[model samples]
Target: MIDLKSAPELKALEPKLNQFFDLAKTKITAIDAEYDNSKGSPVFTVEGKYTTRGWTEWTEGFRYGISVLHFDATGDESSLKSGRDQTVSKMATHVSHIGVHDHGFNNLSTYGNLRRLMLEGRIPDNEWEKNFYELAIKVSGAVQAARWTERQGGGFIHSFNGPHSLFVDTIRSCRILMVAHRLGHVLMGEGDKPINLLERALQHIESTAKYSVFYGEGRDSYDERGRTTHEAIFNTKDGAYRCPNSQQGYTGFSTWTRGQAWAIVGFAEELELLKEFSDEELAPFGGRSEIEAMMLKAATATADHCIENTPVCGIPYWDTGAPKLHLLGDYMDRPADPYNAYEPVDSSAAAISAQGMLRLGHYLMAKGDSAVAEKYIDAGLKMSDSLFAEPYLSTDPKHHGLILHSIYHEPNGWDHKPESGKAAYGESSMWGDYHAMELAVYLQRLIKKAPYYTFFA
Candidate 1:
């Protein structure tokens, strides 16, 4: 479907790929420039804009993922050095505030940093670096186990706030916990405990699959009593436990593009872990067979939903059930006032989803589902290409983000209103740029690997 054999076609697109890479390099440099070591922690903001503003602890993880991709693509010592240096600098502040719940995001990415460093033999012998590394591992392991212990019902409660709140986005967030388990086992030399944690995470994932699947009768779509419809919004308030309601009372609701994307990627990663662990190692935590089956189901359901709902260009509106509306009121509404009522297509979410689907294709191929796997891979590649063609991704100082016209949530009234009074374009955001960079690196790898792996086998 994607024509991986089309070397001529791919070669024809070389210039665009080169341009995308150059743009990515520029963005990485810009992010590095925004780093302030004197602040003691990496600020989420870049050039006066909030990059990691909402959940500040996750910046280290984001940086780690980004840096790893950068190093893999370009042998630039500076990029690698910045990644390690930033980790050290950020950990200084993060370790002091190591709370109970957010550690998954903070530490998961840190583990990525550690894994990369260890593989490259870059672990420093310095007292601070050595101490922090061990401390990070221990703290991360403790937090992960504690979080798992607090699960309620089928899915995990979003955070420590309590049982009734479960955000689908946590699917991606939970990977940090799995990473901790894997890394802990490796670091400690031997033990089945890490395997146990991995199994627990899989259980939580299975529970999520049970409750959050988008199709089939009796599937929990919306809390009819809550007066909201949709899968996008999980809780009524920021930290509350109230269930979300549906829009029309019958169209099982609440499906956010990012949340769906998170589950798609999360399930795929779980499948990878399940395959890597031995059958003997998986017995204590509820056997690898069950986990594999659950992951396959989730991967299929989530990938299907993504393919059906997402635009051909690979961008998705905030929520699948968002009401189609247009701007009609005056432009001078208050910052907090609700105005627009449509789901703004989020390029970042689509990009991440495409990467997840690509990974899923590889996973499927590994299991011998060649034809179906190729379809997934082809769709993902085409989606990536379509997203790349969008002009909003141009890197200009006046542009706030890589892609323009992203909708945060129509119900929330957070559309990207252009600041420059440009009716044709919307506001730029950091999330879009980050995902675009991620997509570039992922596609580069996928393209390189396609020649050797036949999807039609």
Candidate 2:
């Protein structure tokens, strides 16, 4: 389990956070310089260099969004220009992308970050530029919302797999719908019926909470609280949930750590988004108290599971129940060994989950729960400390990836394994790199006493 008792505070981690930003400037610039956009979005590192994979075209935003986030942290105009130019020149398809459940991951990271900067007055408030971004986000959110698969009482934004699949990753993508609703946008359905974006988002959120997350109440033999399935299959005809499944983890019964990380950050961000709405706005769904309680229950359960399951340093293996994990006997008693011959650690999951812990911690504090809040915040800081240093953070200028030891599609044999190691290691993914930057920027803002960072902000 993650050793939260000795975890450092946010103030203590300031120097490392600053160091990470400094290193990020070079890493972001290097990727921008070397990556050939024509090949496709750089998916993950192969032997320390970035490469592409033809998987749903979901990562281009993270590639460009890294630059935008770099500019946000260090005020680098060059990075800003690269991000803005790419968003204009390259991201239109993602805005109208009707095939995938990643609009928030693609659009929010780029256009959303840019719009947040404009709202903060960090950039010149050009009215047209702001509208351009707003329009893009509005379209992106509606397009994402339009990919709905109706269930009994609600529905989900189905994965590219088809109408019957509900991916846990889309929980975070639901942010696009929330943002579009905030901007006074809605999806126009058949016969010019205006569909409420917020309702769609809420339904998707509740569906994920109900179907994707296991609460350990014996839904299945393998069910465990806070254990998240990568995918939930449903019968489209009657909208009946079929079974828990996995695309990247070892099996349907196992918890893919990255999917678990998605749930962590996804629900935490939803809680933060909820703060912006009035009780009246939330009444139609379940009212603010009920909604908050449901989200809080899911958030805390997953976080507690993470703390209990991860190694001492707060990093986890790609999947908790990876078959070979038993080979690394007593693994949880020590720090995660990324170089272990048995199973590789996934720093990318750590990067994403750390932010979730931090945000959930802050949310709890605001609600007058200081003791439990500190545990999550400290666990987040502890994970950040592990990720910003050697073996995880790539210091080699020749390596295009910013963070190392990220795994993608382990079940498909898609990740590159080192020539010498039996397991996959020394790789970084686009989502992994982007979330690490997001985590750094979050802490950087806190350290500098800057405006509190949120996607909506």
Candidate 3:
């Protein structure tokens, strides 16, 4: 069993963290050579096997941001320049487009990185930086407002249009929105817009809470009102809408481990954002105490579930309730091609959740709830330590991906499969790695800040 109560010493992790960052930088540099900017977006893969080659909208920006964060942590000037240039190039092309639904994902990393650049004094007062920052904030606000759904208690929906489309992934997307709001406040000397955005965000969170509760109950995929109709669908393609002609529900009701991790991290992030608001401002939505309590509940519940279900290595299966491994062949719509059907633990999800738990623990500690906080942080630290020890992380030269054994499809009987040989990594997703890097950076920051805050108080 993964020990939640015991934490590996952080000092031991320094070398591993450095190695991971270096590996990430090397991989990112190699990948950049394949980017075809003339084609308008980054290509999906470098191996040239898959014909679908346009830049995937979100991942490109995410990669740039991750690169920036890695450089910031390591002070690698060349890596920093590469990340900055990539972000600047992408922001120039994509930031103004209103049609894209993933502005939060696309812009947050791009502009958020730029904001960090400005804060770090790496970039001078330049017009390009200024323009990108403004554009990011504007586009993010638009997307958040556009995706707002009344049925889900007022939270942002997953994408622009489509039935059966409420997703837990919005947790990450919403964090971008929060980041935009915070940036606007800090950079533009603005407050009202941030306040309004926070209110909208809180409403959305309440809606998510309500819909998520229903989803937990396992009703129909969506109600007539268009909220999540079921309670048991942990990971869904959409929030509450069901695919029209299929009883199987294209909603993707399987409990995606990363999506769950996103929720745990996202909720903790939202609580932090909300705390920035004054007590009076937060009063109407729910008092600060209530918000804190709700966050604590979510943190504890998800952390417990993650610990209980995570594998011995601290990685989690793609779906918590996935059917037995042997029975996978029986349910395959396609032949059990070893190419597609291999079960693997999602290392990225484990990393992200571990980081989220660490943050949640810090939040709890601030609220004078150290026991639960310690539990959460220790769990995260243990998971990170296990990930550090895995030989598979460095052994497979072809496996450019960070974590192994992630399941892209469990119902189709593809779990714990090697993503190395696959054409596109079988959705051995980019966002997972993005979150993993983010978790590492955040954990490092928290470790530094926590002692000072606790000591001074």
Candidate 4:
């Protein structure tokens, strides 16, 4: 479907991706700085140096995931060993963490990548090691899925905020359940409910589709076809939907670019898993076709917005409706300027969303929409190529982050607003750096003619 034959882009990218891994190993990973693991993978950088900022260890997985990707992309065995060793030494507690709603971000990147590597024959064929990885994934997925809130039709994995909150951010975490379901695992809920994880996955996807994603379908007064809210609040008593809310964005009504990226990545990635499900496996959720249609709709809408909202370089301001962005007239027509003193460009949004666009483009091409698919594919590749170069990439050894200008929480004033005071430039986020590696690895694999990165795989 991707039509990789004679891909000029792939041929051009293969060497650059490998070179990035080489530079990252020395500059980013080799740094002696270590933040409190409790802060979740060092939320952001100050003076281009990382420090702890998050409340939970939500991003530890990304740190570990980048290692796996480094090895996968560059065939650097030390990177692989770094990934395996870190998971063994530090990831056990994350697998069983109960309070936070980030098992997918914590355990999945570590355990999930380990299993995926072995399954791909990149790691040695050791059954004990494989089973260890699998068991960890099974429990991690079940534990994450067990954080449930039931509604009239079904339930969703609740956020750390408890039963009343559903975040677009958690959609990517639902992959923990998707992978667990593929392994034939299920979560045990109260009343001894044998909660089917696949069902819960679909339920959450469907819930996010209805509440978080805007389709200009008049679900609410603010609804626009491609607009998405960061958080969706509901009344716990009856699961009746409440007003839109946001923890990271400027306001409940504004679209957080990272949240939009999550919707794009979550739906696009899950759509691939949806195809792997058997008819019987999806019967509880209106069959595979119905589920596919649901996910496809969500992915499509998000990708459309991603293309429309981003600058020509495929980077976006942290929030589309960020109040001060009016200063940067025609930002969408040209590459975003990080020094505008109006708003910072989120390379993290570009890193995360580019892959989502690529996946969606591939899916559409597979589904007979090549004309539209090419646009998405080109957009994704354009973003990916930009991220691999200067200003975005950390070619400077002084910079501890791979991608720059990533904000952790703009509204909270937690991000380091550089000396300019105009925008939070000269920074990095754990998610941003991790997703940049992920974007590079996604393209790297395609160029190398290797197994595609898939949650189901």
Count of backbone clashes for each model?
13, 0, 33, 3
Top-TM-score candidate index: 2
- Tens-place lDDT digits, model 1, residues 190-299: 45333344655665666566555544444354322111122323433332324443321123465666667767777776676566568887877667777678678778
C-alpha positional error of residue 434 in candidate 4 after TM-score superposition, expressed in Å: 1.1
- Model 2 spans with C-alpha error above 4 angstroms: none
Model 4 lDDT per residue over 296-395, tens place: 8888898888777777777788998899988887777777887778888888998998899888888889889999887778878877777777778777
Give a tens-digit lDDT track for model 2, residues 120-155: 999999999999999999999999999999998889
TM-scores for every candidate against the unseen true structure:
0.74, 0.99, 0.76, 0.95
Q: Put down candidate 3 lDDT per residue, 353-410, tens digits, no spaces.
A: 8877777777788889897778777778877876654532432334445544333333
Candidate numbers, best TM-score first, in rank order:
2, 4, 3, 1
Candidate 2 has an lDDT of 0.91
Alpha-carbon lDDT, every model? 0.53, 0.91, 0.55, 0.80
Off by over 4 Å in 1: 1-15, 34-56, 92-105, 117-138, 148-157, 185-195, 220-252, 325-342, 397-400, 403-416, 419-425, 449-457
What are the runs in model 3 whose C-alpha is more than 4 Å off?
Answer: 35-56, 92-101, 120-131, 152-155, 160-164, 183-195, 213-254, 326-342, 391-399, 407-428, 446-457
